[model samples]
Structure formats: C-alpha cells, structure tokens
Target: MDETWAPEACTLPTAERPFRVAEFDDLFATHLRRSERVDPQTLDLTLNPESRATVEDLTARETECCSFFTFTLTGTTELHLRITVPPTQTAVLDGLLA
Candidate 1:
C-alpha cells in the first residue's frame, strides 16, 4: 500500500440504541441509496454477526494523508475502511465530474 493512501485516525458516534446485525445492514443499504458518489462494488462490508450488541453508527472525517471512513457496529466502533480506485475506474470517476 502506498503511504499516501494510508487511512487516518477517526471516531464514529455510537448508535442511539442497540440494534441487530440485520438492522445495521438496512441502515447501510439506505446510506448507499442516498449517496451518488458511492458504488455498491466499492463498499464491501465484513461484519461479525455472532457478536451482537447495541448502538450502531458511523462517522467520517478528513485527515492529512487520506480520508477516513469508520463504522460503529455494536458497542465497538473502530472499523477502518481503506478504499482504492483501480486505474481503469479512476478515469471513469473522474470523467463523471468533468
């Protein structure tokens, strides 16, 4: 991984209340639908369903190196996601705005 692409430190807010894994999925799906810049293929989620807890939330903040995306699943909220745009698709994303 390139040093420039390293993820930055960030914190996400805890969910208002406890929710099941399925509830988290529904929230994630709704977020995806509302965001035009986000693609389904680029958003890959690996959640542990066995460990259930209350409070599910997410927060994003910018850093000096790269933008940080974090998810708060259950009580623990330290999930860091690193997203990479392939050379081929890089052009596609750029062209969309241009």
Candidate 2:
C-alpha cells in the first residue's frame, strides 16, 4: 500500500512508535478474530472480548494520520470495528485490507 495520506513521515515520535507497533501486533496476533468489507469503502472487523480498549486507543491515534477513516466500535457480546473511508480513499484502504 502506498499510504500516501498517512505516510511513514507522519508516524508517531520514535519513542511512541515502538509501543504503538507492539500494541497493534498484540491486537492482530491475539485479539482480532476477523475482518470484512461491509460496503465499497467500509470495513467491519470482529475482535475478541476485551479488545475495546486497545481498539479505541489504536483508532484514536490512527486518525491523527489518516483522518479519512472513521472508526466505530459496537456490539456487546461480540465487538465490531467499523472502518469507513471515502470513495476517493477506497483503493488505498483496499490495499491495506488486502
């Protein structure tokens, strides 16, 4: 993915980057259950129990770089992370999701 909007140049400061990387790695490695495309530019992701805090923190920081994305988390028993992007950014998101 090109990630032109959220280029590596916009990554968090060095000290924070590692922690974010570790946090996302943990989320992907153990918390994420699955991901799906709910619409042309929307992604519906399922996460395991207890991932709310991590997902919130991650998405909060993500918007700093990629404001085009909108993250909405919902559900009680099962959590869902809804990531919505504009039509102009769908291809970039598709590459990321791929």
Candidate 3:
C-alpha cells in the first residue's frame, strides 16, 4: 500500500470529523484471514464518528470476496470509497495495480 494514498481527512459534509481510508495490505490480510472475520473495532481505527457509523451500516450488507466495497457520504461534501479484499494473492496484486 502506498503511504501517500492513506486518507488524511474527511471529505464528507462532516469534514470537521476525522476519517481515514487504507488499502488492505499483506499484514492486514494475514490478520483478516486468520481471524476469519473483519473486526469492526480494528477497522474503526481509521474512521471518525460519522464515517464509523457509515461503515457499521454498510458492512451489514452481504458481500463476496474480491468485491469492491463502496462508501458514499452525502451532504455538502461527498466522499467516495472503493474498498475490496481480494480473493487470492494474485487478485490482491491485480487490485493494487488497479
């Protein structure tokens, strides 16, 4: 993951709130698979109150591996995200390139 791509601030209407977006890297993948479930608490580490709420809500929807998880924040300033946990090592590498 490129450190430069790390989210620095909220781009939503709740810009006053803090938020971050990070690509799932090797370390994170190892932990995620080992756990067999994505830990919301750990994921929350990169989010603000509003963004956390949004994530909590979105994660409830059923999804499949390698599918992109998209987040759209409404209100004054809109924020978008394309999150994905690739299915295989090759897929992960491909996703990173994309």
Candidate 4:
C-alpha cells in the first residue's frame, strides 16, 4: 500500500490500502465528473448517475476504516457526494485528494 500519505489513525490494514486506493482511482477515472474542495475540511464530488452502487460500496468500506469521514450521497439523476471530516482530520482528507 502507498502509506506515504495515509494517516496513522486509519485502521485499514497496510496491505489492503493499495487496493482500496486503486478502487478510488478507478472510481474517479470512470465516474467522477467534477471535484471541489468546499472548505478546508470538506470535499464535494459529482459523479455519473451510474456510479450510485460503486459510490455506496466504496464509501461504506471507507467509513468502516475511517469513521471520521462524513459522506452524504444525494441527487437521484446526477449523484452528488459531500465528504466532510472533522477539523483535526483535515490533513487526512487532503491526502485523499492528492
């Protein structure tokens, strides 16, 4: 796994993080339409409507390992995702974008 940016608080096993990251990269490559950093601690993503299941699954597994994230997925036709982390975890969120 690429532990270079992964925070110490992440519970995802070191070996599995690369796979998780690959999934995210694939998701972004395939479905991400737009990405915005709403604030220092928040990120908003716009994805294709066809990405609902993938987003749901990825976010679910992500939260299981990094509970600090708060993800809200909405928009029936367009799929909007809002990801927020607490102030203390802002750096971790930034790592994801990198």
Candidate 5:
C-alpha cells in the first residue's frame, strides 16, 4: 500500500489508542441509520439522531491520529457523516468500517 497518507508527524500517537475493531463495530451496530458509498473512496453515513455527538467525538479523535481521513457532517435534523480517504487506502478504510 502507498504510505503517502501515513505521515511521520501527526497530532495524536497511533500507539496510544490503537484502532479498536470492536469500537467501530459497536458504533455502527448501535448508531447507524443508513450508509452509502458515495464513491470507491468515500463513505456516507447517516447516523441516528442520538449518535451525532458520539460520531463527532470519534471522528474528531480519529482526525488527530490519521490526518488522511476527511470527516464531514452535513444536515441538522438528520445528521450525515461523509468519510473520505485516499483511493489507495480504501482497503484499510473498509477493514476499519466493516
């Protein structure tokens, strides 16, 4: 895989909070309302109303560690999170979101 997205310096230490598979699994299992693949490298997630803060917090922390991730939230009554990653990192993104 191309290491372009994995920069040497970042805001958070990856080793401090290694990506936990269960964390994501639980987040999606409990909060996901609907999901769509905006494209091969972008995922659009519409989460339950109550899950907005949780998702925001999670993504915020994620952005600290992996600057490659682009997380955007649009809409108010119904929140949507658009997660974009480099094309070369699709597999890694899939594994994390799966």
Candidate 6:
C-alpha cells in the first residue's frame, strides 16, 4: 500500500508507518481471500477463518493510532473485515488497497 495518500490525521509516526503497512501487506498476502469496495467510504475484506485473531489484533492497533478509520469484523465460520472511513478520509481508505 502506498502510504503517500495517508493524511495529516494519521498519528502512527513516520518511522512506524512502513511497519504498519507491512503488517497489512502480510495480512493480505496470507489470509485475505477476497477484497471488495463496498462504497466510496467503505471496503470489505473476506478472510479465512484462521485470520480472525490476526485481523482483530491488527484492526485494534490500527484504530488506536488512526481514529479516522472504523474497522468491523463479522462472521460465523468466516472472517469478514469491514473497513470504513469518513467521506473526508476517502483518499486514505483508497490507499488501503493500493
């Protein structure tokens, strides 16, 4: 993901941003089964059941530093991650899958 689109609201720190991006990269490579843009403000990631814990942990940490984002996980036998951002943060959300 290109972190260039990240806005001023991100407080993850310049040094740690790449690491965060790497974590997302790993998650997408390892467990992500499907990806969809639900709307201009939202993205949906369907991951394997095995990714529940990792997804939860990552999203939690992400929300801690980037409060502009809203991450939701829902599914019974599957892991569904819904990432949402306010309309003003659409560019940041777009960078998520880039």
Q: 1-98, model 4: which lDDT tens digit per residue?
A: 35467777789999899999899889989999999999999999999999999999999999999898899999988999999999998887887877
Separate clash counts for every candidate? 1, 0, 0, 0, 0, 0
Please provide, for model 5 over 1-98, each residue's C-alpha lDDT reduced to its tens digit, 9 standing for 90 to 100.
Answer: 22233345445544543454445667889988899887878999988778878788888877877788899998777889899988776765675555
The digit string of per-residue lDDT tens for model 1 on 1-98 reads 11222212312222312232234445444432222335622433333332233213232222221233223333233322323344434432232212
| lDDT tens digits, residue span 60-80, model 2 | 987886677788899877898
Q: Order the candidates by lDDT, highest first — what do you get? A: 4, 6, 2, 5, 1, 3
Which window of ten consecutive residues has the lowest lDDT sum in model 2? 1-10
Q: Which scores greater on TM-score, model 2 or model 6?
A: 6
By summed lDDT, the worst window of 10 consecutive residues in model 5 runs over: 1-10
The reply for model 2, stretches above 4 Å from the true place, is 1-25
TM-score per candidate, in order?
A: 0.19, 0.71, 0.23, 0.94, 0.76, 0.94
lDDT of 4 at 58: 98
lDDT of each: 0.31, 0.73, 0.30, 0.90, 0.72, 0.90
Q: How many clashes would you count in candidate 4?
A: 0
Ranking by TM-score: 6, 4, 5, 2, 3, 1
> lDDT score, residue 93, model 5?
63
Sequence-dependent TM-score of model 3? 0.23
Compared to the true structure, candidate 1 yields what TM-score? 0.19
lDDT of 6: 0.90
lDDT of 3 by residue, 5-98 (tens): 2122313223311222132342233222222123321111222234434444444331222133332333323222334432323332333333
Cα TM-score of candidate 5: 0.76
Best TM-score goes to which candidate? 6
Q: Give the TM-score of candidate 2.
A: 0.71
lDDT of 6 by residue, 1-62 (tens): 36788789888898888889999999999998999998999999999998888888999999
Span of 10 residues, lowest total lDDT, candidate 1 = 1-10
